[model samples]
Target: MVARDYGQYDGITQALELVGERWALLIVRDLLVGPRRYGELAAGLPRIPSNILAARLKELQAAGVIRRAPRSRIVLYELTPYGRELEPVVLAFGAWGFKALGDPRAEQIITPDSMTISLRTAFRPQVAAELPATAYGARFGGDDLLIRVQGPELAVTRGDGPADLAFASGPGIHRLISGELTPEAAIDAGVVEVLDGPRILLTRFATTFHLAA
Candidate 1:
């Protein structure tokens, strides 16, 4: 068993300390999907300074939230089971805070726009059959995003894609598709934006995926 270092406040205090920093939760978010090299984490989280990123990783390691995996004599970060246990915590906080506070910016340091959510939740069809083999860039918000897609797994930066279609509806896409938010509402409120792509294509793309609705 991983020993608990905290005596009075016990393990909870240690865990909170590790994740209480400005950028720590995002580190966990990125790592939750899979193990990541330092550079990959840095690329996804541009706001975190190099030194702080290194420190937060170290802190998580010390607190038993994350561990390093051996890779070609280098190390990549992966969450320990204890770390994975925090997913509910993160999600719960997001749910409650977003509802109660009107705007949940406290933990949401970054407002993930439509493009980010679209890629995250959509069905990634085979790119080899759709677009050219040449690598292309996907820009969400102000930054060029990264995802990786393994044979059956879809990741953003490292994933192989020249996706023939792109959807940029942000959070409303998730809501509309899930039936939590209506498509008409999203369109009328301008909460969703479709850029440089076919609306029918997006409609077809959205319907193809079974997203809990």
Candidate 2:
């Protein structure tokens, strides 16, 4: 049960009472990427107050949304099956929120987990199904992600390696994802830089993963 309960016994109200608190769903978002130690969670959500993180975690655990487990001699917080079911909700919410995203604020930093979920949200599995297998090393600010696309499968993991294309971009990548800029235009405007590999793959990258703005 949530720490607070509304007078009404509605389902949506109950759901909100459980995981609707500030920072709670974001915690679930990172956990969707994978399990993480408490410190790792804090590092991902840098602005979350320490006490708030602890309290949210405890509340989520109590609500059966998450649980703590020992991993490699360290405690890790991970989602339970019920929590995993929130993946689709997060992806849809992310795509819906993308419409309102303008230029990022100066202090807004993109973490690997945020980028991972965003990529998943924007991925065009049907379009990618027709493209050749491709790998990309993507850099968003100080974060690095290895993206592999084969048919309808898409995987974004932390690291960089041999890829069909490697590109670096900050928040301007959003423009590309939102179709505000084409691949060629993005490169010309210096919104995206080719780090390595053939530049043509950048066009494929844009086609394979995009959200209609």
Candidate 3:
């Protein structure tokens, strides 16, 4: 018989042990988006070695953070409900750490509101007649901006801060987009400030928002 070393740790220690590795968090991040096959996970993470990812997946499954789903004959790894609980934690930590590190991943983040707003700002005329003039809320750098079309449908950019909005409130767009604030909570807490028009107008415009396909 062959033996393998399975080190021991207390409850908290074990939790940390599972999540504390450099690449481990990215694994969780990928699964948070949706369940992925082994190859898909490997493809998404270019830096990690296949063997290392395999080990981490096994560890997470063993710890009950993930589970193996049999699709066809091959097994796919997906986060367990318990594992899914870590989404907010992971996203918060990623947001905070990315800010500190000034990583490129920070630039890629866009909130649903921001995404719609940016589309309006960048490509509004394409769908201007289709969009209504509403006080759409946005967040960036932890500050929320209530975007209102006071004049004509105007083009917007990142630099156009402190502009007139129907109303504005809440945390910055950056956090809200990052799952730091759900759309409902943003309104309930009055953190989402508004300006010129009704917030529902913002919701309406958001329907036309698009992202990089």
Candidate 4:
């Protein structure tokens, strides 16, 4: 925690003091995906100043929000159980913020971690519950994600695979998710390019993952 104190004896204030600094929550967000080396964290948050990153890491470690551990003989930063409790809060926050998310700014870029969270926030398990099992290969910029839907279960992992539908898209995929465009419209408008897969599966993909504007 930082030296600055809010002097409030409340849960929200205390929580903010622990992880309220700029770039602090983003660190936690990435860790929510998995443990990461110092270099990997820095790479994921390329805009964070090195000094600030180091300071936030130390503070989070001191606050019991995160800890350094050896993984495969290499040290990595991961969230503690207490920190993991913020997952639901983070998901809610993302979903709420997404409602106001407009078009992407020129400089805005999507990292794999951010994309993973986006998909999670947009996924509608209820709709997927009645759908057949399907897998989608999604690529945004250079990041690739394998999204699997089995009944109401959804998993998004990084890497390639023999997916039932493989498609490449940019920020415009948000249109499909927001219901602004149907699957066929997205394809015709070139918002999403079918890389390899049955075109019909794209409709299933739309049915599986979506978020209302």
Off by over 4 Å in 1: 1-11, 100-166, 170-181, 194-213
Candidate 2 residue-wise lDDT, 1-213, digit = tens = 577777788888888898899999999999999999999999999999999999999999999999999977799999999999999999999999999998988998789999999999999999999999999999988888999999999999998887889999987889999889999999999999998988888889989889987
lDDT of 3: 0.55
Which segments of model 4 are wrong by more than 4 Å? none
Best by TM-score: 2
Give me the candidate number with maximum lDDT. 2
Per-residue alpha-carbon lDDT of candidate 1 for residues 26-82, written as tens digits (9 for 90 to 100): 788777667889988897787789998988888889878999999898888999999
Q: Point out the higher-scoring one by TM-score: 2 or 3.
A: 2
Q: What RMSD does model 4 have?
A: 1.4
| Residue range 111-185, candidate 4, lDDT tens digits | 889888878888889989888888899999998999988888988889988799999998878888888899999
Worst 10 residues of 3 by lDDT: 204-213
52: Cα error in model 2, Å: 0.3
Instruction: Tell me which residue pairs clash in candidate 2.
Output: none
Candidate 3 structure quality by residue, lDDT tens digits, 1-213: 101223765665555777766677778877776678998788667667988898888778877888999989887888999999886676456545534432235335433233333334233345545555544445544444444553346443322344323444322433333344454565666645554545554344433332221
**Relative to the unseen true structure, what is the C-alpha lDDT of residue 180 in candidate 4, on a scale of 0 to 100?**
87
- Give the Cα RMSD of candidate 1: 7.2
TM of each candidate vs. truth: 0.56, 0.97, 0.46, 0.94
- Report the candidate with higher lDDT, 1 versus 3: 1
